[model samples]
Target: MRRFVFGALAWPPLLERVLGRAADLRPARLPGYAVYGTGGGALDPGTLCAVPDGGAEGLLILDPDPEDGARMAYFNGTDADGMVTEVRCGGDLVSARVALHDDAPGDGALPWDQARWLEEWGPLALDTARNIMAQYGQTEPARMAGLRPYLAARAWARQLARTPAPAEVRMATTAEEGVEILRDRPGHEGFFRLRAFDMRHRRFDGAQSPEIGREGFVAYDAALVLPYDPATDHVLLIEQLRYGPILRGDPRPWVLEPVAGLVDGGEDPETCVLREAVEEAGLTLREVQPMVRVYASPGYSSEFFHCYLGLADLSSYEAGVGGLDAEHEDIRSHLLSFDRAMALVDSGEINAGPLAMMLLWLARARAGLRAGA
Candidate 1:
């Protein structure tokens, strides 16, 4: 049976894997069915259902081979278990099948936009699929669904680190030349992944260190902007519940922090901060000044940050609820004068590292920035 991919299954690289060859996609229609989907990441899902007078527009998979059918059954959740249906391919209404999910969005579900999906989610999903397929047979589809969200984010983080920087300097040693990865495996895959490694690296003394056992948390890059009203000398901070502290059993899990978010795959950090400013704070950013590009904790995580001081007119913006309903972000912004922010810092009410660092950086550069504003 040929697989007819109407959703993310059309992701090119993935399509090639499923179809053996990336067969030319042609205009096709499926009648008596409506396509519905819900999922932000690979974990979020899609399915097709029977609906009278409803049809979906998608590409037809020409003549899939037996191998293609088998692989499709393995990876595409619906192919493995979804109900078989009929689709109109050219003049013939051939028998086809779809996997349906109950969680698929209904009523307001937009038609599948293939180009948009490839642009925004293609890269993340591509990498996520590779990681998932790599651990195939050892894990179940249910487990992959659970790991999908974080794995997608981890893919973005990896892409960020892989972003090329203009030549400024060259290191004496690169991972290729100085490090040998004997065995590296996924230790855990959830909101974050635990990666266990057996490797050796060059030492400062020009000798190879013995093979070491180490594990690290695979992290994604995040955008952090400290919104400063250079004209009024005020800064805006956000407070939200954080799971890290709560999981640690800290008395306070609510964190006071900057307007921050994960940088989507193929999105630049600068653009990410601007997008986040509106989504998280309902404010537009102007003249964003770069603070630094550094790892949150280099020793054990790949979480990187593109810190910035975003200029905005927060003179009227008040402490209020913010964040996206779909993502369940319940954020509150606090407009604090320089002194008030400092008081919070002094009192430990502001404990998030990014908030504290941004505040400190602003204190020293406040005069320089306002001078230009």
Candidate 2:
């Protein structure tokens, strides 16, 4: 059994999730050390450091579950930096251990604000802890720290999926009526993840289906843009090597698609498209028209995309190579006449779904879009 003095950053619910049990946090105070935000941002978690006469107000957790000690290590991190020390709580000095991280804000960087953190970063941190703790023995602290933002984004996406559309389908698309998730478990972890499910759901015609097991490829929601120029009557397409086609044994794996990228956590779909435009094709977006927001594939993946029709001047645009090297993206852009692009779609040459959908949607809305509306 061991006891620790948590600082202002100590999140009780978060720590409980990390330890996989119910933990009671008693109000406490610690002296001789301080906690501050790591450089990662106000939301990146905290960095603890030793200081003279400085004190931290937090909670106390004693005798944590032993089964999750290794898992807790990733959160508490190695005690290599901080040491066993004495702190005062309610006028009583007690002995406890403290752990600190080297990188990020340490002492004197930013004053610890528990109330503000709970208001602004609390939910994000708690959601991120769900995935971070699930990795447990499978990953290291540094890697987890780097993945914090994306993990939080992924958690946000997962929450969005859980929100049922209000009364959309009377028979019950909402879990309260027809669906129930019995067990949900994480399968793999990394830049992308796979989640497994075992559950039962309602079938059409008022019958319940037997329990069925399933899994889904968890991917961040994305934003896709099909740049179009009415004055020039041209549309831009980006071609790149896609692993899905090659893996599926398609003879031609170089798939042509729009300027698209995954949406970062807390970013707007419109902003994401504009950012992707510059990164994928070096195009400056003047105006953008939202086409539709949809799932990439409902059967096997949770990937959603916000499609857009970006209005831009393409008269002087030239076909060339562009893409961010950090992501290993080697892309080539092609400007095709509206007629020629549709011809390719008809001939089955343009098979990428987002591009195809945007082309058709543009065909329907072209007249209004061209009229400067």
Best by lDDT: 2
Q: State TM-scores per candidate.
A: 0.71, 0.84
Instruction: Note the clash tally of each candidate.
Output: 2, 3
Question: What local lDDT does model 2 show for residue 273?
Answer: 92
Which candidate has the top score in TM-score?
A: 2
Error of 2 at 164 (Å): 4.8
Each prediction's whole-model lDDT (CA):
0.74, 0.75
Worst 10 residues of 1 by lDDT: 37-46
Candidate 2, which ten residues in sequence have the lowest lDDT sum?
38-47
